[model samples]
Target: MRKYFHIDLNDRSIETQTLSGEALARAGRHFIAKTLLENDVATVDPLSPDNPLIFSAGPFAGSNFSNGNRLSVGCKSPLTGGIKEANTGGTFGFALGQLELSGLTLYGASDEWVVIRITKEHEITFESAEPYMGLGNFEASRLLHEKYGDKISLALCGPVGEYLGLTSGIAFTDPEQRPVRLAARGGVGAVMGAKKVKAIVVDRHKMPPFTDRKKLMGSIKQYGKLLREQPVIENFGKLGTAMVGDYTNTIGGMPVRNFSSGQIQDPKDGPLQVGGQFIAELNAGRGGETTHACMPGCMIKCSNVYVDEQGEEICSPLEYETIGLMGTNCGLTHPDQIARVNHIANDLGVDSIEVGAMIGVLMEAGVGDFGDEGFIKDVLTEMHKGSEKGRLYAQGTERVGKHFGVKRIPVIKKQALSAYDPRVIEVTGVTMMLTAQGADHTAGNMHSIVCDDKTTEEVTELSMGAQKNSAAADSLGLCVFGRSVTEANSELIVEAINAAYGCELDPSFVLETGLETLKMEHEFNLQAGFVTEDDQLPDFFYNEALAPSHKTARHSAQAVNEVRSAHF
Candidate 1:
């Protein structure tokens, strides 16, 4: 029995509800989809008061399950103009679960900014947060922590969210309590800003009792052993997601120079500056860690902490997407420089991917030379100042591209693509083209898609499978990377679930929940005026041939729609 919390901004009130019976199956993502549809907000403007921001923690949270602390942030996206669910791994999600909370639905809008605090004793407090205005995510978190003390978890935004940047995301602290992890993508933080809520702090002083302590302990140890033995997971523990940069560049999937080329093609150095091993060595020399966990009890710690020349922390856990879009795609060669931009973007509460895409488009337009550190710093300063031009940057790459008259902008539904170049790793491109959430790689992956004889048909099929699995993982609050160990064996997760509530749930129910979530979101998008035509990459992807590989992306609108229709 999980509690449902609904908070009204205008009325400054909080309410709690509970559901059981048939609705129990529809928890987390499923429940969120149902609530959005019931509100009939399919066609409502995402930034309006009527559009609610829903946050849900899945069944695995608060349990001894490994990698089960992902926080799913759900709402009609201002960026995609469709239902959006982006997640982040952190203690907040687990804390919510420990507090026995299933979901939090926020509605209405406030005239002044405020902070919402929830205590372990279930006491709620609202404070005027105007004094903390213009603060960055890190600063805001520190001040909140000072006020509320330890044993509390927080979800907050920075100046980017305060200004309603469409690319901003809600930032949260990791297990060490650093505010670096984020529910990053699809303009989620903009929705938070619209509600005029600066932060939501949850006290984690108490936790619910487990159903079976012995089974939980066994599941935790067994899953930890399984993760440690997997070679991929082991490597992840050594190098984090940035390790994929070198592999993606070799595979012709790295986005370089605004997607003009995959690799930098320098015969002298051979893309070493953007390589993963190079970065791992650089950080190691600086006493920065390449392997760290975003959530507590995560067996596979595929995260990092970057340090500057003084060996002070520059950023924590910079990912391949950040390196690909901001580094190679923008003609940057130094890992330190990329880390600086990542720090700036995160501190300012802007999505690094979105800012990176904007920088790439600007580089393509000759606004600044590629690999110019000063130019990068200047652009970041402008964004922070919110100048007339910086205001354009805040909107997103599509707006900036249209303003600059750049014809080859890589965007879908007004949202920019991630680091993956569509010309290679074809299935991921298909996933971006077809998913209701526009151009999101995390929504699906390219795994299990490539075949001996590659074809557009195979890409579509592989993307569909990955999307379904990913949807399932996100809904269950499980990390998709956990698929490595849990793919062949789901009983571990089932055991954890059974231990949580003493329920005898089937192992397959997790995936089933994810499948239903996808269907609900798909229907919501259709009702929100999305059509088969909207499911597509840019026209340039189909025609433009990428360098080195010299391959062009090819997929039919009919084929993609068929995949979406049949599966979703």
Candidate 2:
């Protein structure tokens, strides 16, 4: 039996419900889709008390399966005004799983500042959180650890979220209790802030039961050994995602200076200064650790620690998306300076990608100058001080672009592009255009989807297939990195799910569940007033040709609609 703790913040009431049979499909992305559709919440205002945010752990969460402990945070996004599900890696999901629980449904708004604490004994407590209000994420984490002991799983927010910044994200502490790993998209934290929650302290000490522990252990060990031998997985452990900078720049897909060009202005030195090799050197000199895991039992440790000139900790897990948008896109070549901005973004509890894009738009509007470290530092300070521009900046890239009237902003459905500019990597651009998540890279990471020969005619199928595959992985609660294993060897996933829940499921059944989840999500978006016209990239992507490659976005609105209408 799996438990669900429904915490209504309005009356400070905690209720427990049990889910079983077909209802508990591992509680990752799929479970969220089911729950959202069941509640018919798509048409409701996202920030209203009626919209519930679900925190669900995957089925293999409390087990030894590699990368098993992912937390799926789903809500009607205040950012996209549609259904949003952001999955993150960290200790929080596994901790929650120890309570024999699949998920927690958070509803109703609190009258004032509140903190929800769940203990090892399953006791839920609500307390005043105003004393800790306005504190940045790192400090708030330190104070929470001091009060709750260092091992407690914490999900917290900073001043920016409390101020309802549209880009605010929910920050979760890693195993070492550092506040960094985040469900960092779609304004999930602003929804929590609107619910009047400052932090959620969960200390679940009991693990979920496995029907056949011996068989489950054997399957996980076999899969783990197989993943260890993969070269791509190995590189992820070594270089992390920051390695994408070198390749994207070489291909002329890296957005430079707010999508004005793809090629770096100083061709000889630009890539060298801002790419992965620079980050590797910085790590070597500062004694920072690379190949760090954000979650327990993750075989692909694609994260790193970043330190300053004095070898003092600045931030951890400085990612490729942050590298591209905050580094090359802003004309910033100093790795440490970018790391500092990444750190500030984390502290402010905002999405670093959105912040970086917003800064580029401001530069385009002549409010700031690109490549000026002092100017960026000053801007960050103003955001911290809650100045008018800072508050405007917190509204995210799309709103800021609208305010500043920047034409060439690289956006899809008002959300800023992650690292990949659609001009060069055209297949991924297709995914960005058609998906309901609104320009999210993970909507279906276009990296893995390819045919024998990638052609314009093949774009729709590749993007649709990638999205379907990704949706399946999300629904299964499996890391997308693990897709090579679970997808290719579907029986392995079936075996694990059967062993976890004592249920019988075949490979096709697993595939269909994923497809169904995507359908539910698309239906929800439709109900939220999203029409066929919203499926294409912004106007500039259609008109502006990127440098070097010189290719504009080629997908016509009709082509995109054709993909959307195929009914994936």
Candidate 3:
């Protein structure tokens, strides 16, 4: 059995609920959606005290299950005005699993900012957060560690989140004590900030008991073995996610110069500097880790620690999205430049994709020159200082575009579109248009699909399949990068879950759970007054033809919604 805590911040009261079998096994994203629906969270103001922030852990958490220790943070988004589940790879879920806790929900607003600490004994206490306020994630985490100890994992609301920046995300500690891993997207950090919670500290303990320890261990080994034999997994282990940029750029699917062009540099230029191959080689030569795990026991280590020419750390993970939107989209080609900005964004606990898109739009509005490092640095500085202009910039891409009267804004449902150029990445485009999760690719990304001969309905079907798989993975606290193996071997995964929790779920349970979660989210969005038109790509995508590919968005919101309705 696992304990779920309902913490009311109004009077600092805690209520615990015990869950077992299927309930505990299928937690994380599903739990958040179900709980919110039951609590009528859809009708509440997203930033109000009534809006609960949920944190959930999967059943395989704290075990040596690869990509199985992710933590899901969910709330009604202040940015998108809809359901948001932003999961991150980190030790927070592992710590919860160690303590035999499934999840926790925070209700009501605190009278003062506080650091909520959970001890090994499950004792929850609130401490003054004055000392950590206005500090960057690095300094704040250091102070938290000094006061608490090293054997605890932290979830921090950064300086940007202190004043409820819409681009802010809650930062979680990576294995190396770096708070670069974030539950990033949909203004989750703003929700945390609204609750007046500065941080969440959980004490680490030994792994919790499993129902069938020997069988679970065997399943873990089998899963790892399967992942090892997969060629795609091997490539990811070598190059990390930056390789996606290479493929996207080559195929004219990468967003370049504020989504004006699909490709950044011409092929005549030497190797694409911002792409994964170049970055891996560069980082490796500079004594940096080209492949590293975001969480403990992740065999497919697709994260990295990028460094400067001096062999000093710039950022822990210089990912493909940051490379596409922040590097190429902004007309900056150097990884070092992107890494410096990435470090600053991480320090602020803001979503780099949103921040990057915002900067790109600012450039589009003639506020700054594209590829100007000085302009980018100045914007980040203003954000850090929480100046009036900085706060305006922090409102995110869509709002900033509106303020500047920019017509070429790339956003859906009020949130900025991710690195993928929907015009060229057609199936992913369909997914972005259909998902209630705003313009998030992780909701369902099918960028690898060859869409030249495909129909809108066909692409929507493909998107639905991918979305189901992704939803299942998110609900299970599994990383989507492991989908190649996990989706192909659902039986093995279900068997592992059964061995761990003694549940008798069928192989089809994974997709079914995903479908259910999607339905719940869709229903929540409807209740929140989201219309079919809200699920659309911007007009620029339909009217403007991207260079190289010269493809405009082919799917309409109505057609995509019809297909989705048929599926449901």
Can you give the TM-score per candidate against the true fold?
0.96, 0.96, 0.99
RMSD versus native structure for model 1: 1.9
lDDT string for model 3 (165-243, tens) is 9999999999999999999999999999999999999999998999998999999999999999999899998989998
Reference-based lDDT, each prediction = 0.80, 0.80, 0.92
Candidate 1 lDDT, 1-568, residue by residue in tens = 7777899988978898874323433455676777898898889999999999998887766765778777788899898898888788888888887887776889999888999888876777889997678887788888888988878898886777877788789988888778888888889999999999999999875455666778778887888888888998987778788777877777677888889887764435554665667777888898888788888768888888989777899988778888988788888878888888888887877777888888888888989988887787788777777787777788888888888989878887778898888778778888888877888888787732454376666678788778877887787788888877766666777777677667788888767876787788888999999888887777888888888788887786677777566664
In terms of TM-score, how similar is model 3 to the real structure?
0.99
What lDDT is obtained when candidate 2 is compared to the true structure? 0.80
Rank order by lDDT, top first?
3, 1, 2
What stretches of model 1 exceed 4 Å from their correct place? 19-26, 265-271, 447-452
Query: What residue runs in model 2 are displaced by over 4 Å at the alpha carbon?
Result: 204-207, 265-271, 448-456
**Candidate 1 lDDT score relative to the true structure:** 0.80
Q: What TM-score does structure 1 among the candidates reach?
A: 0.96
| Colliding pairs, model 3 | none
**RMSD per model, one decimal:** 1.9, 2.0, 0.8
Clashes of 3: 0
- RMSD in angstroms, candidate 3? 0.8
